[model samples]
Target: MHTVVCIKQVPDSAQIRVHPVTNTIMRQGVPAIVNPYDLYALEEALRLKDRYGGRITVLCMGPPQAEAALRKALSFGADDAILLTDRAFAGADTLATSYALAAAIARIREDMPVDLVFAGKQTIDGDTAQVGPGIATRLGLQLLTYVSAVGEVDPENRRIIVQRRAEGGVQVLETALPCLITVLEGLNEMRFATMADMFRAARHPLTVWDREAAGIEDITKIGLKGSPTVVSKVFAPRPRTTRAELIEAQSGQPNDLADTLLAKLFTKHPQLGRQIVRRSS
Candidate 1:
């Protein structure tokens, strides 16, 4: 079985700051790391590779610096890494990103057939969660989102089963090979990189593909021209000013404390008490 995992290098959200005047993200000094959610997908793919004894390729689309993200995946035992970077892919929204990724994957398929593709549920910077589904749609692959666990894989039969997370419970789904899965976090723990693997990753010759190399025929379908979504504004939320109120009772007993709390709540908001009474009646 051959698997391809997609990952993105994102600015650390913890250290991200908003520009005061521009009301945009200040990424100049922010540290970049692999998207945390994508790590779960990568680990899952690595686990599959370990069990099935197949090659795993890590794919990423970003600037040249994003090669670091692919190398990180390599350190985790991926067999190969591919970086899709070009000026034409700049300022791409989810649609354009999916288009470019789908094209690149098709190019990869020409060389070696890909049986599975994995991605994170969403990116931290862009929580839209649309790119994976978009890629699946474009590639005509079975789309599986919010996958909690992979249950079984029958390579001979070209069938696979997975546990998908739903609104109230989990759904067990069976699909054919060549499916795309957007995995939820906590699917599996990432393995620690061995010193040998780390050295190998540092020295690995990464496959870098520009637009033409990635088999992008239409220039208009990538980058800013293909992106239709517009960000109206970007700003930080205002800090809340309300403070918590403490209720005290002389008795300091649980029952006394409950009564005191209810009395204070009723006194402070008479409408709440009336609503409770009305609902009970």
Candidate 2:
């Protein structure tokens, strides 16, 4: 199938901290893990590989440290790993990131033609859900996001079918080859890595490419300059000071409990009580 799965190394959310004064992410002491959503994407790619007997390439764009994420993918049985790292790629927003990734994928195409590109619906840190679509737009690939299930892949005919999650229901979509998909979470369970796979991942020669190697000719299209979005400020949400108001039923009866809660709610918000009554009518 010649699938490429895009992944990222993100600070573990549970261990992430915000600077007290600056209110920016405190990444110094936080441990980095592969984005959980991307794991699902990788698992989907692996499933496709198992079915079709094709190569799966794990791709990542981050600092040198992001090779850890690529290694993790290799342990999961990916055929190859590529890390695109450069100082020029620093402070890149989704736009710049997609551009760099599309460029790298183009470089990969020079050797082997890619049939499908996979990515998470969104990164845990960014959560913009834009990069996949951006990459598809830049590469002129068919865009499919929030895919809940993959139906059929006909490489001979160059067509694929997928179940996409929409606002009200699922939409079955059939698209041409060279498509980019952003897979939704909870589609399938991830397989565990075997001992041999672990060892192979440890000894795997990761392909590391800098900006020039990745075929980024325009300096202005990468790094901070390429990113148009800017964060004016970051702040922690204010903690609530008020305590929960407990509704105690004197009788220990379900009806009594409901009555007590309703009384308290009505007392607190008379307008809400009137609205509820009007709706019932």
Candidate 3:
């Protein structure tokens, strides 16, 4: 019943700004916080830990500054926290990120066998939503995405059931153990950390691992060299120049107002009016 939750430190979206000249995200001086979506996964893992009485480990791969994100997870009663950081891991795309994460998890498995791994559906910064699935593919773990609820965990039978979100309805899926779940937002609300837990988090010794420590053997499979996707251009949306025109009805009646609006619309765009009539006919 050991669970590993993957979290990421992201720039607060509310404070994020685009550079005017460079047309890129202005991360400088932006406050960093744990990806909000990941909190749902963490809270869900905590709930499972409370019920099953098992240890939970919070893992993250980022720069040294990401240690704060791991410490925050510690305050939420995670049994352990691991930060995987290295220069080789920088500028990694989803593929490289998943590769590094999968390697670290394998390293962690040597000490304590991990039964389940939880992660957010996607990161705020990188909304590609590919990393979790990539990790599952690389690790050969059962992949379950957009899980709204975890139904049952039968460790003795080595099976688990979950409610996943689909297009029209929810799907109840029964999967085997050692599965990777990408939790959707609004699954559970995060709990407040107790004063004791806060103190413990402050004093807790974090396990920091570099590339070699995390057992990443393939040098060519990490960092910028491993990233295949490239951002060619980023720019702010152009401001709209068109202004709304007001249509007035003297009588203020619904039919009159509609007629006035339609008249104005037809006068403004005769082709649109003809298209509407053709569609109706």
Candidate 4:
């Protein structure tokens, strides 16, 4: 079984800087880290590989620097890593991102058929959570999102049982192999790398693919041209106009302040004061 996990490199939220002219995120010089949500997905995939005995592959789509995220996953025990990087892939939204990853999965299938595809619940910068479903839909694979646990896997029967989180409660679902799952967080813990894993990742030759190398035939469908939605504008939030009124007591008496506040509150909203008094009573 070959488990493929989709991960992303994101600008650290604490250091997000917006472009003054375009309002787009100024990712340059921003400390990039693996999407925190993706760590849960990667950890879940690693758990499955540990139980079922197979190789795990980490896949990411971003600039050349995104190789760091892939290398981080490798350090945590992923068997292989692939970075799909290209100028044509810039400014891609969720739809285009799904298309590009789907193409890469197809390319991987040629070598070793992927038994399972995993992705985080969503990206921090782009919390669409649509790409996983889009890939599953395009590839005709079973789609499972918000998975909390893998209850069982019947390799002999080629079927797996999983627990999925829903609005009101959890849903127990059964699906076959070659399924795509967007895992929920808190399901498993990421393991620490041994010295050997760290050394191997430091020297790991990541497979970098350009548009052509990734078998992208339709340039329009992989980048800005293929994205349906556009960010028309981004602006800073406006500050609130109103300020809290301060209650003053001439003699610094707490009871006097409370009485003045009560009078002021009743003057502004008599009904609210009535309700408060009733609740206090």
Candidate 5:
């Protein structure tokens, strides 16, 4: 089986700072790391590689700086890494992102046929949870989202089974290979890199593709123009006007606090108070 794990380099959420005027993230000083959620997907792909004895290829779509993310995946023991980057690919939403990735996958198939594709459930920056599904849809691959575990893989039959997370509970579903899966968080821990792996990754020659190299003929379809969604405006969330009121009383008695809160609530909104009381009762 040949497995492909898609990864991304994202700004550390804690360190993300937006430019006041430009409305763009100030990534210059911010620390960059592999998308945390993608780690789980990588580990899962690695596990499958370990068990199935196949090559694990890690792929990413981002700026040139994103080569770091692919190298990190290499350090984690992924067999090969590819970086899909072009100025035209900038500011692409999930739709356009999936277009580029799917095209890249089509190119990858020309060399070695891929059996499976893996993606993180969602990107922290985008939070759309759409790319994986979009890729699956474009490639006509079976789509599996929020997969908690891989139950089995029948290579000869080109089939696989997985445990999927649903609203109520887990759903065990079986699908065929040449499928795409978006993995849930905390499903698997990343393996510590061995010295040999680190050396191999550090020296590994990466395949960097610009628009032309990525076989992107339609310029409009590859980047901002091709994207359907538009971010008309992005601004910091306004601070809430009202702040929490602290209740201070004799010895901070709980019963007194509760009663006082009820009284205040009822005075402010009698209907709301009645509804709450009725529901509690």
Candidate 6:
């Protein structure tokens, strides 16, 4: 029951800024943290490890500084950490990222057969929600997205049941082993890292792999070259200038309050009152 969890190091959205001239994100002086959504996926994997007593591997693809993200995962009790970093992987979009990750996971499978893979529903920075599905398709694994709960796992029979959140209602899904799941938020709470685990995480030697080590055969299928998406512009939304209006009821009763509110609303916008009268008629 070996599990692999994918995480990303992203700039804190609250501190993010856009370059006015370049129309790109200004990462300078911004702090980096693990993607919040990925934490849910990691927690789910940790719970599975606790139940099945299997090894858990944390994987990340980013710059060398992204090692901090992997170490954070280690502190949370992951058994192993792997960082995929290379100059050739620069400027990768979701497509290229999934391709590289899929290739690296294949390399990992060579060493130890992976029973399941887990990832977040989406990244805060990109918010595209495409990479997980892309990885699943590349690896020919069962794709499970928006998973709210993992119900049962029969490792002996390679069968697993999960509760998926859909637009209409929750769907109970049963799939075989070697599946990839993109977990939604609030799936489970992350546990606090113990002092011993923190010490171990600081001293653990991470396994870093370049493109060649990650078993990437085609150079044209990774990095910016493989990415077809283009960003035309990046900017902040305009702030609203309108202010809220307060309505006071003299009687301080529920009916009086409602009447006052409706009177004020209709007075401010007569068209609304006309529309209501027409509808009633």
Candidate 3: give the clashing pairs: none
Model 5 lDDT-worst window of ten: 243-252
State how far residue 215 of model 1 sits from its true place (Å).
0.6
Tell me the tens digit of each residue's lDDT in model 4 across 1-281. Answer: 89899999988988988787676778778899999889999888888888889999899999998999999999999999999999999999989989999999999888898989999888888888999999999889999999999878888788989999999999999999989999887888888889998899989989998888888899989899989989887786665988978899898899999999988999999999899999999
Q: On a 0 to 100 scale, what is the lDDT of residue 106 in model 5?
A: 84
In order, how many clashes per candidate?
Answer: 0, 0, 0, 0, 0, 0
Query: Candidate order by lDDT, highest to lowest?
Result: 6, 2, 3, 1, 4, 5
lDDT string, candidate 2, 210-258, tens digits = 9999989998988888999987876789889899887788888999999
Poorest stretch of ten by lDDT in candidate 1: 230-239
TM-score: which is higher, 1 or 4?
A: 4
TM-score of every prediction relative to native: 0.89, 0.91, 0.89, 0.90, 0.91, 0.87
RMSD to the true structure for each prediction, in A, is 3.3, 2.7, 3.1, 2.4, 2.3, 3.9
Against the hidden true structure, what lDDT does model 3 obtain? 0.93
lDDT of 3 by residue, 30-63 (tens): 9999999999999999998888878999999999
lDDT of each: 0.93, 0.94, 0.93, 0.90, 0.90, 0.94
Q: Give the per-residue lDDT of model 6 (tens digit) for 1-281.
A: 99999999999999987887776788889999999999999999999989988999999999999999999999999999999999999988989999999999999999999999999999998999999999999999999999999989999999999999999999999999999999999999999999998999999989999999999989888999988887666567765878767666888899998999998878988999999999999
Lowest-sum lDDT 10-residue window in model 2? 230-239
What lDDT tens digits, residue by residue, belong to model 5 across residues 147-252? 9988889999998999999999999999988999999998988889989888889899999877787777988886889899898887878889899987666868
